[model samples]
Target: MVSCYSSHGMVRQSWDLFSSMRRSGFPGDGFTFSALLGARASSSCSDHAKLLLLLGISVHGLVIRLGLHLDVVVATALLDMYAKCGRVAEASRVFDAMVLRNTISWNAIIVCYGQHGGGKEAFELFVCMMRDGCCPDELTLSSLLSSCADMAAANEATQLHAYIVKIGFQDFLQVGNALIMAYGRNGFVQEATQMFGMIPNPDLVTWSSMVSSFAYLGLAKSAVHLFDRMLQQGIQPDGVAFLGVLSACSHAGLIEDGFKYILLMMRDYKMDPTPQHLSCLVDLLGRSGRIKDAYDFVVNMPFEADVDVIGAFLGACRMRGNIESAKWAASKLFSLKPNDPVNYLLISNTYAAAGAWSELAKVRSVMRNMCGNKVPGCSWIEIGGIVQTFVSNDMILHQSREMQKMMDLVSLVERYCNDDDIICNDPSLV
Candidate 1:
């Protein structure tokens, strides 16, 4: 009964049966505990993670008392439970204490670190796994590539690609898809396109990655071209693929194409628009100076308008100096995300741009009292194989002598250009 409940994902029922088993003096064995632990680990609700971790720890105690912790199956289950529950430290301890390990054990721990934003550590573990005579398979490479993508470790990703080619795993669809995403995330659009071409039979994920790569680089025509090619190849697009095309249209201000894709997704593919798709459409119309249309679309959306939708409308209103629409959007946004400083910032900027000083003052006062300090904008750039992040008002970076030299050089160039007729003063020519 316990196993059945756990298998079917009735976590509460599984726990209840587990307690009942203990009360009935039926001390569970390794298999029973594994089932319970697996159920807890795979619980869908993120808010239940802490509770699941506590329950898993109690089960771990029982496994130790019963001497089942030494069982490989039981140990692997425990390791996976700890890792999935965000207890990376505890998972590491379990991994280190294991007298015997398998590929599953190694993959679990590597993925644990990878999923928790420990990309560097996960790569180190991959190195350690190789040293211990455990040859990495497709899963290992894919996990490491995913971590590299998340961290934007392009240099490491390139090395992994070479490794994949050497190991003959490059032909595997999963590894191919991972490589595409990794290259795309690190701004290697050409390499991503190459990877996409290399795939003998590209799936939806592969097509989506290529389209997204083009979209990310602001090459909307190329992105749309790829989408058309994908359709010609008889590969159906999923929501993600639509998202990439829609995003390309939004960035390029191709409002008609955006609407056409939305209608096609609904009528042809029979796919309901996801929040991301809807957000892209809103952005498309908003960016094309159709603020009223975007506002109407948001108001008529089947689902409640989310932050992204409202933010898009508000941004368009700000650009067009539509004070009335901005106020309405700002009210909706405030109710949805009261603590978001961007919401307050956008509304205040709109009022200021429209020369509504009283409204601007009121918005500023509310922002000061409610939202506190505005978050500084930040950007990252990779140089010399390292990612360097800079934030607005960062005195440390600003004070750097190297930066000062660059600024001085820029000023000198500007003065020289202004003194001569070599540089055109017209905005379009410059």
Candidate 2:
């Protein structure tokens, strides 16, 4: 009953069942804790997630009291639950508390950091995983490569690629696909294409990754060509494949091609368009400067327009300074993401673009009151073989430390350029 209720997200029922089990004198074990912890992680959004997080904390207390915290399986489940709850620090604590960990344990922690843009943390954990002699699986490499892509750490990606080749994990399709994407995202599309060529019996993901690489480079013709080649080989295109092609078309202003693939995905492949597909369509329509058509398409879609679609519409409106369309899109965006400062900023930016200073000021005032804490943007620098990454919040969190780092950077520059002979009076310096 606990598993059933938890799996279906019946939070109250799951807890009631657990209470009944305890009353029935059936001792809780790792499986019981795992199931209950999973229920916490299953929470979707809004107040319910908060409620689950509180309940999950209670469960953690119970686990500690019962001495089940030392159980490797239970500890792993707890760590995973904390990670899923967006409590990275707590998750790290749980991981550090564990005496024995397996591959899945390392993976859970690595993935938690990776998903939250903690690329430096994830990489450090990967190094620890290797130092501890726990062999990494394909998913591990894939997750790390994904972090590399997100960070645009070209040097890191190249080094990871070399390590994969050394460990003979290059043949793993997941790793291969991730490497292609990482290389492409880092502006090494030719290397990505070469990697694609080297893959023996490439699967659907390999082909899709290659297509996306081309699409990202605005090589729409090449993307479409490779997509067609995949079809010719009798591999049915999935939603991702269709999304890649649609994105390619959108990037290149090939609205006809975009519509063609979207229709083909739904009609020929009998697959429903995902949110990403719709967002790409919005982009395609917006790129063509058909604002009304795009707005109408979004309104008339089977599902309501999500943040991405509305945001895309707003972006197009900004380009044209279409205040009315921007307002309309902003209204929908605000409803979809009420507390997201990005939405407020987007609308405010659109208003500024339209020279609606009064409206922009109004939005900014509202943002200051309702959303004081926005997601922090991150930046990084490589110095002396060390990658120092920081986020916007760090200024307030560690202003002195950050200032010191900046001063050190200035000092390093002075060491190289303080004399002014190398850079002074050089004609190219101008």
Best by TM-score: 1
Clashing pairs in 1: none
Q: Against the hidden reference, what TM-scores do the models get?
A: 0.82, 0.80
Give candidate 1's error at residue 380 in angstroms.
2.2
lDDT tens digits by residue: candidate 1, 313-382: 8888898898999999999999998988899999998998999999999988998888898877778666
1-430 per-residue lDDT for model 2 (tens digits):
7989989988789999999999999878888988899888877676777788888899999999999999888888888888888999999999999999999999999999998989889999999999999999998999999988888788888889999999999998889899999998878988999899988888999999999889988899999999999999998888888988999998888988889888889889999897789989988888889988888998999987788888888887887778998888888888888888998988898888778899999999988888996776678765554566787546544455878789897886676576587667555544
Cα deviation of 264, candidate 2, in Å: 1.3
Q: What is the lDDT of candidate 1?
A: 0.89
Quick one: RMSD of model 2? 5.6
The clash numbers for all candidates, in the given order, read 0, 0
Question: Top model by lDDT, which number?
Answer: 1
Candidate 2, overall lDDT? Answer: 0.87
TM value for model 2: 0.80
Among all windows of 10 consecutive residues in model 2, the one with the lowest summed lDDT is 391-400
